[model samples]
Target: MLQMDPMRPLDPALPITPQLTQRLRDRIIRNHLKPGDRISETEIAKVYDVSRQPVREAFIKLADQGLLLIRPQRRTVVSRIAYQDVLDARFLREAIEADIVRLLAKTRDDALIGTLRAQIELQKRVHADDLETFTQLDEQFHRMLADAVGKAGTWSFVEGVKAQMDRVRFLSLFDYPMALLIEQHTQIVDAVEARDLDRAEENARQHLRLMLDYLPGVIAANPSFFDLPEGGLAPSVNTPTLGGEYT
Candidate 1:
């Protein structure tokens, strides 16, 4: 069983229900609550020193997110990560990101390009010693790029899907080379600065491809983290066919 710190702080401003819901969601994404694990609202309330009413409300929110399944008779379990869902989410993300790059190339925003360059430099420095900070900045860099194209809302949708893949990403961080990621970001920035749409798209595609390539190894090492079919493992969300064309 995965153990979690009971004393973790809740978002003080949020209603107790949403606070609990977000906490549970975080636990699930962080791999502290594995798929198909049974979760009891009563137990959670007790653990968090909260009332059952709040826990019940939280569970409902989680169920709506597809992170939890509420069965008949008040039982709830963490939903298994569906392979098709992952594929669909990745497909949408790739399409949106490709569009982002095309828009960015046309705009040629020097200020935004400079910000991205600074982010890449920070990514290199922190990645060597502190992966946690590097991960946060890495996410910011991508978001910043999308924002530059006036697609922050689109990127938020992308992020919702990406959240489902966080566990796999966390696992890959242990084995994958961070230097390669930095280099990929740098190349994309260079292409954008040159106002080369085709080259920027190719670079972005390559960066996502690297992530797709790493999925197999991640699943191999942490089989329990994935939702594999009975007969064989499923392909990752970032399959070549899905991301090949801009939609």
Candidate 2:
């Protein structure tokens, strides 16, 4: 059993499985339950004061997400980060969001621009150590862009694919370049405001690719957290042309 702080009591009215799944996911991503750490349904049930059935279901859900590895009559351990999964997630995001920004740039909407700028302001105010709040705001910032262009469902798809990237992100937050990211956000907003479709697309692509630049350092610093071996090759991705047609 992993020793940690007591969980806050779950509400009786809510469904326990989804809540438990999400909380457990957060624990894994935030490193409270680290990679390769063995966790058991029986032990988790004891911590949450819930029955093992819900805990088992929750574990299965996370297993499907590649966060847990369940085995018969063996200890279940947290999955290490898959470098390819992270790259694939970034590729999908860059493809989807590049088009999203281009569409938003084609039309000038002061209201949308204002909302995004306000979001950046809020992001700036987050304390450097408050990564959880910053992460939420960051998601909101991108989701708002997709929502503005009536592509909320498309953004939902992005969310589904980005879990692997999120784990890497949370781990990298200790040395996160918050100011640089905020500046990138500002540039993205500025491009859209100016109706620079190509620039907006480019800005979005560059922002999404920041992980590509930092991932190597992160892997080196915490080799045990990732599945990629030392000297493993990162995936090579072709840069998409600005305003390129989506296949």
Estimate every model's Cα lDDT from 0 to 1.
0.75, 0.87
Model 1 TM-score is 0.84
- Flag regions of model 2 displaced more than 4 Å: 1-7, 229-231, 243-247
lDDT of 1 by residue, 66-181 (tens): 67889969678888665555556666676677668878988998988888898898887773657768778878888998888778998877866666666567666767678888
Least accurate stretch of 10 residues (summed lDDT) in model 1? 238-247
Model number with the top lDDT? 2
What is the Å distance of residue 120 in model 2 from its true position? 0.7
Clashing residue pairs, backbone N/CA/C < 3 A, model 2:
none
Error of 2 at 54 (Å): 1.7
Candidate 1 stretches greater than 4 Å from native: 1-4, 127-129, 234-247
Angstrom error of the Cα, residue 47, model 1: value is 3.4
Q: Name the lDDT of candidate 1.
A: 0.75
Q: Candidate 1, residue 161: CA error in Å?
A: 2.4
The top-ranked prediction according to TM-score is: 2
